[model samples]
Target: MELKPIKTRKIYEEIVERIREFITSGELQPGDRLPSERDMAERLQVSRASVREAFSALEMLGLLEIRTGEGTYIRQVNIESVMSSLTWVLYMEKDAVLELLEVRKILEVQVAALAAQRANPEDLQNIEEALKQMYQDLQKVRLGEHADERFHFAIAQATHNKILIHLMSALSDTMERTLKVSRSKLYEGKDMPERLYKEHALIYEAIRQQEPSEASERMFAHLAGVEASYLV
Candidate 1:
């Protein structure tokens, strides 16, 4: 039988893994300061650049907070953010990207329904504000990716389920990247941005009117359109 070659990791990735182990083993705690880059480099027997690279990645994952004058400290762990960052790296293949969209369709359709039935005034206001932002971006011929993400996140918040909110947070970064790619493809059709905005408007209207089924349907349709654009 033929064997596949072992994959080699970058030095910075190995450093990241080591720091993750430290956190997992309780050697690092929230608010605990990390060693200086020089110290870490000497301890790890690697260059300072690798340690700095690892620290930057950790900061992006919300696992570390780097203050300008105060140095780097462990941030209160946002497990969801960490998971999402890992997931983003692992699922960059075409089939994996489609799988991510499938997961989104499953979770978001139900999330829209729940938001329709349970949304408070504040939740509605947030969703409307995101929708307004989308329109503003469209008027300026921009992608409005942030507003699109905020719109869906606001709907998830409206569900009032802590677990669902956490799950959405975990998926947020990956979804944002997917949307940016899909929107670029869709915008090639000129009217596609307007079409997308109208679809979001319909979903919001259904939720605002407390129509769970309609909200779910609209959300499903919107996601299907995105998937189609991505495939194109």
Candidate 2:
């Protein structure tokens, strides 16, 4: 009975809140395979990727079970576990947040260059797949944060360095959190998403052409934009 319309820039977070309301109200009972992503997105007037991201985050928090090919279902509640995760995220400081971005820049810039130089056909395909998803989401006016993460992760994987891969995997959650925080600011302008997509395309083209320097430069420029939007 407490549900309200979502009117926030943080679309995925709002979707999560709404779904959580459904589950808590027993409207979506345990073992219920929730609506398809397309259906929920249409009903909520959000994008499918936003709904996907919301479900992904809920799965991480153990509140939902997403069975591949079947559907998403409400998991048994674990109040303490959920609260602990929320508390840990709430405890992060601004300085610590910036430090996370700093570390990402240090690693990902080199990763992009290396990927341009060393990526095999399969690696290129994965990166392109992420890029394709991003483009599709953007066309629908979705933020595509999850696809952005996938694009970066593809670059990291292309490095073929286990240590770097492990590092990126460990930092994924923090990176995702930072992206969510900054997306609204970055996309405040009407044309920002189109510009962002073009930037990403330039980076992808550089990598495709095996131009390491161009890849690094494009990656740096993209991250610089993120920094300016987020920190300034």
Candidate 3:
């Protein structure tokens, strides 16, 4: 029932959207072959180049499969790929990295509070291990970025929320890049990494003691420090 007549400069993009809608509306199904580019162009009254570009973009988005000597088929979409693409899109937006930190503060502050209440012995042990690794990495004159990430992820694991875990995982790559940028700036001052380690220690202790309020406060302070460091 939706119209697909091209009216804009970005004809290919509109074509892509129409195809996506078709798939979403159950008009198209996985493994169903699509009309050839020439045929589609003729049907839509658009250039073959526009149709080809549309198909190519859809393929990149994991929406379509184009096989030689065959035809285009709707591929089984992977939600992870869609999530990754969205992250990349956000990464390219203006002030997007800073926006990412704001989002991190929202998710991680609550995550810390929940972790404090929900963590079992094994979860606590994992959190402790990550903190210890941070210290060890610093002693070895390394940045310990991986350890820092593990520390946050360990807290998320303690929350026992599968959806939260997956959301965190989806954003982890972009978050790591943002963290590296922030850490580089923060580490320029004397003893800054040491100070950061202390902050982590405080957060770990709060969670270890199962103090939800303290854990949340410490997590908020830590991220605020990170933002101040990078944005300043």
Candidate 4:
């Protein structure tokens, strides 16, 4: 996790990765101010533009809090900030949010499938409780969505795979804000809770049945509907 200087063929990207590693490894902690832009360029032995672009990328991820005339500091970690910025990735002017959704489909469908096969009795109980909370909060659609998000997050934690959890966490953070925004715009303001409750119930049942494939399908199907309803 040491922030080595960029050495790869794609120099700029390597620089970006190294900078990320610095924060990841605690070489730079939250609220820890970074050396000046010029200092970073000189220390990393890269052009100033490279440091600027890398810092910009990190700032967008909420890794670095930049203040005019004050300097840049490591910001506290938050996931949705990362994902929201990732949503803007465009290739040749074509929207890649759909591709991002597909990636989420792959990761989360597998997460649900794993939760079905591997989730402990306690995990099942927790998920059910979360579902119940969601059901009760249906009258408060925003509350329901919050509970719903927690229910799925519980499933991810149940897997007990630290690396997988970290990876999914990053991905989840990226879409979380958008998800909330879209939910408010499309569902919370209307009759969206019923459908959401139904969808969560379907997934919950499949997990309770310990049917990994069924659980995965339910999750994927739910996400597909969500994408069509919101991100698309």
Highest lDDT: which candidate? 1
Q: lDDT of each model, Cα atoms only?
A: 0.83, 0.79, 0.82, 0.74
* Ordered list by TM-score, greatest first: 3, 1, 4, 2
Better by lDDT, candidate 3 or 2 = 3
What is the alpha-carbon RMSD of candidate 3 to the true structure? 3.8
How well is each residue in 1-232 modelled by candidate 3, as lDDT tens digits? 3445677887987888789879879998889999998889878889999999999988887888999899898998677556655554555453677788788888999999999999999999999999999899889877777888899999999999976776676567777655666666566567877888899899989998999999999999998988887877
User: Which scores higher on lDDT, 1 or 3?
Assistant: 1
TM-score of each: 0.68, 0.58, 0.76, 0.63
Error of 3 at 31 (Å): 5.5
User: Which residue pairs collide, candidate 1?
Assistant: none
Backbone clash pairs in model 2 (N, Cα, C under 3 Å; residues 3+ apart or in different chains), count: 0
Q: After superposing candidate 4, which stretches have Cα over 4 Å from the reference?
A: 1-96, 141-143
The sequence of per-residue lDDT tens digits that candidate 2 reaches over residues 91-207 is 344457777777777778888999999899999999999999989988898877778789889988998987677667656766566556566667665787788878888988999
Clashing pairs in 4: 79-173, 80-173, 83-174
Error of 4 at 232 (Å): 6.1
Candidate 2 local distance difference test against the native: 0.79
TM-score of candidate 3 against the unseen true structure: 0.76
Query: Residue 177 in candidate 4 has what lDDT?
Result: 45
lDDT of model number 3: 0.82
For 6-50, candidate 1 gives per-residue lDDT tens digits of 234577877777777788789889889888898787777777888
Poorly placed runs, candidate 2 (over 4 Å): 1-94
Angstrom error of the Cα, residue 46, model 1: value is 3.8
